[model samples]
Target chain A: MSSRPGVATRARPSAVPVAPARGRRRKRSYVRLVLLLPAFVSLAFVTIYPLGFTVYASLTDWNLFNFGAPVRFVGFRNWIELWRDQNFLIAFKNTAVFVLIATPLTYLVGLMVAVALDTATVGKRFFRVLFWLPLMLSSVLVTVVIGRMMFDPFVGPVDSVLDRLGVPQVLWLANPRTAMMTIIILQVWWGTAYTIMLLVAALESLPPELNEAARVDGAGEWRAFWEITFPLLLPVSSAVFLIQIVDAWKVFDIINVLTGGGPGTATQSISLLVFQQGVQGGNISYASAMAWMLTVTIAVVAGTVYWLSRRWTD
Target chain B: MRRSKGAWFFTYGVLTAWSLLLLFPMYWVVTTSFKTRPAISGGATFVPWVDFDPSLQAWRELFSESTDRWLPFFANSLIISVVTAALASVFGMMGGYALARWRRLGPFASAQFGFLLLGQRMFPAALLALPMLIMFQDLKLLDTRVGLILLYTAFSTPFAVWLLTEFIRSVPVEIEESAMLDGSSRLGVIFRITLPLVLPGLIGVFVLVLAGAWNEYFFALVLTFSESVTVPIFLANQINQTESVGWYFVSAIGILSSFPLIIAALVLQRFIQRGLVAGAVK
Candidate 1:
């Protein structure tokens, strides 16, 4: 034991060692790089390469069917065609309508629910889970269960209630007018839970001082909420706003399952249009152009939300 | 805070109604699943077990020989989700630790790299669908479990990276440095100390990613067809088929498909709450 020399100094108990030799240090860094490489490389291949390919593919007339044919570059033609394409225009309009309707409605309902839950003194956790259950369920299942079983004009519970109430049996999904409304209702019911949970989290995370200060100033609950609490919540609200807009813009699975972009293109969002064109109709490049257009629109909306939120905070 | 009894009643009433409204579909699916076909179609009873005699016919049909495909679809969903979550957790943990510990890149560089990684999730999956499909076609990965696992891992890794990085950053660096001073290698320190510290976060990420991939519809719809169809695809097909198929069966399948995620959401509610706020508001 006494002959075990230099074991203590060799330990060199310090926070971090001043690394030994430049070449060994370089080799250690190479190890670090090797560890990091798998993630970034796969990310690049899966995301970056595909994104670059999409940008390039958008400029060409690449049909899904003609795999063996030479691809032709038709710069800006797909974009130009999108401006005049009736279905694309409808899809764009529907997508905008969905974002506009869904975002605000979800925000208001979510805020209300959040406020309500916050005010309640008991069983908050239970209600939180209850509200979030819809969001947890897959969109595909939500759409299917709601579409086929609950809203079906023939066997649906809603229609059954209508029949009981002596109201007419309206074709909720079959009519062009109600189809979009049905989609919106389904979306709101499915989506509001997430917004509520988000807003609830935001509400819970709020510092108690502001509201307490407002109360000390003799402000009413409503007044304090509007003047102090709401301002503090602007960041979360804007985040939820932007996220909901992006999500509503990307509405595909629900519409695909619920209405299949019909009663004759009534609920056709840009995502559904992309699917129809790219996968179903084989107009790959056209759909790519549409997808890029949708992407730019989402980016712009999110960016604007960030800018506006910053200015508001300022 | 000093509201009167009437105000309390009103609050509770409104919340109860809203909660019911939000949860009605789930309730409807459960109730409908237990109903007889006539009750499903004719009366649409709210209390299936009480108002009418409940039947397990739909449940039986779901597992019967004719619809034996349901079992395989459920298994595929399980396999895909678990594999994707497991793989994403490993890759994300390693990458996240490297990003956290690699001081050669300054703090700003790390932030930039983090954002660069996360920005991959910002773009819609639709934009990349065509290119990805064509690539999959070339690689002969379409309709394969490995293909979906790879795609989901790629897509979900960014989330895992961001989340795990947050977890790793929260871990005190002093612990790691002390471990390093004890002559432990970086890998050893990570395996011995960092991973255990962040195990809860890892479990959170696993559950979150599991729910995500399990609930995913778009890629599963686009990528796989017959041999590798997931639960979502199976349920979608069942619901989208003709209305002649009774609502009980549709509801039963819907309940079955959503059951796992619902459990996850309830069990992992705190993680989800934190994740939602972290991913966006933070």
Candidate 2:
């Protein structure tokens, strides 16, 4: 991704009385650094400082119970213990399953809707606004509305229809089997909007002549899509895939509002686990260890997605 | 490339169904806000006039109760979002223009730096939960509006830099340089020329950053308790007492929480389109 540095080593005579190139470049570099200084400094306080603090705290035994007590250096104890803990394990599994399931599902639905909108010339702007409605709302707000009003067993329209159809009542939030499923549904509903918009943009950017030429060559609509449009969309698809995976990985609010990681911690995520340990449980150092583990997990997951997409593209 | 009538029909049919499904929950929220208790629990009603008598009891309770914390939380959210948006815009406009034009860090270094900012966006706020609590406690910033404002600014600035850098990049560099040559200071060029050209983009970034802070859940959840709790936290705490609070009030606050962003997003949809497409590039 690098090119040769554009440093021009033009020769100049002393008679011309010109400034030295090195001095000029150095002055420009100083100005650039000054321009960049503020953002870097603020980011250091927010991102770099917090990251360093988190890593350091992970190595100590800093529980809330011992607030006024002297902090003890406990190397790798919190990490090792959390790895073996059942709650952490459950949270890990749930978060992994969520990213795996949600990202691909969002892409599939998003692509279909994007293509449909492309073909349907009528009311494109109207449909775009409708798809974007969910993205405008906060995840917490969306979760609460869906959980209480739309999915409530007794009063929710969903269960109400089921009751009218002679089916018995089923608790969506209480049962372990259905808890995560409900969250996934709400997630797909709330999230697919951005993906759809991105894909629509990608689809619209494609030159019409290419698809038309394919059609002229006797390719059907599906054939044209598979052979022509789909290949061109790979870059956009990879971006959307990686973005959705990251979005779904940090699944806290939806689960919190919908289930509160309940039915005996059935849907507890890494974020929720950290919240419970650090904020609710007041085990600061222990939660920091969990948070560090989560950070590594996210990096690995994101890296693998990027790597896999690169391989496919290659 | 041409479709049969049947195919066109199928496309419209599927889209109409999708649009309806997409709009239903929003409709349900609004209609439920206007319904009485009996009407709410009775069943799903598509028409408010036909099935249920409308009422303002929930809205009234939301605004008037002294013990209720909805209005204060709402105010906290607005203050935090506005201040964060303004501060992030300033930092991003300055830094983003430098990155766009100067190439100060050289090509590879600039790319790496940009990626670093982006990777920060993907960070889990939970990582800061325990640390921020202790840090704010030491600094006496815990549960204060200033604490949330600063935290949100830190959280939002990277995104502002990333997005606004792209926005500035889209404006041709020759324009700024020519202005600079005409007796204008560097900052003068940015203000008099570049900023006006990118004003729409700035508004887009402002609304986008504001939306991010507004929708932020984990920070509001963990960082603040009583003194500076945001609307999301307030509504979430209300959910914990669902036995007493009822669904009507929840619906009302849910509407209150998201209405501003929805309106902004609608008005700035074009800027959003440009930002999203441009944002996906390397």
| Per-residue lDDT over B17-90 for candidate 1, one digit per residue giving the tens place of the 0 to 100 score | 89777667777888788787787666567775477788888888877744775788888999999999998899
Residue A243 lDDT in model 1?
80
Considering just chain B, what TM-score does every model have?
A: 0.92, 0.92
Q: For candidate 1, what is the total of clashing residue pairs?
A: 0
True lDDT of residue A111, candidate 1? 87
- Look at candidate 2 and tell me the lDDT of residue B185: 88
Q: Report the C-alpha displacement of residue A149, candidate 1, in angstroms.
A: 1.0
Per-prediction TM-score to the true structure, in the order listed: 0.93, 0.93
What's the DockQ of model 1? 0.65
- After superposition, candidate 1 runs with Cα above 4 Å error: A1-20, B4-10, B64-67, B103-108
| Candidate 2: C-alpha RMSD after superposition | 3.5
Candidate 2: misplaced stretches above 4 Å?
A1-31, B63-68, B106-108
What C-alpha lDDT does candidate 2 achieve relative to the native structure? 0.82
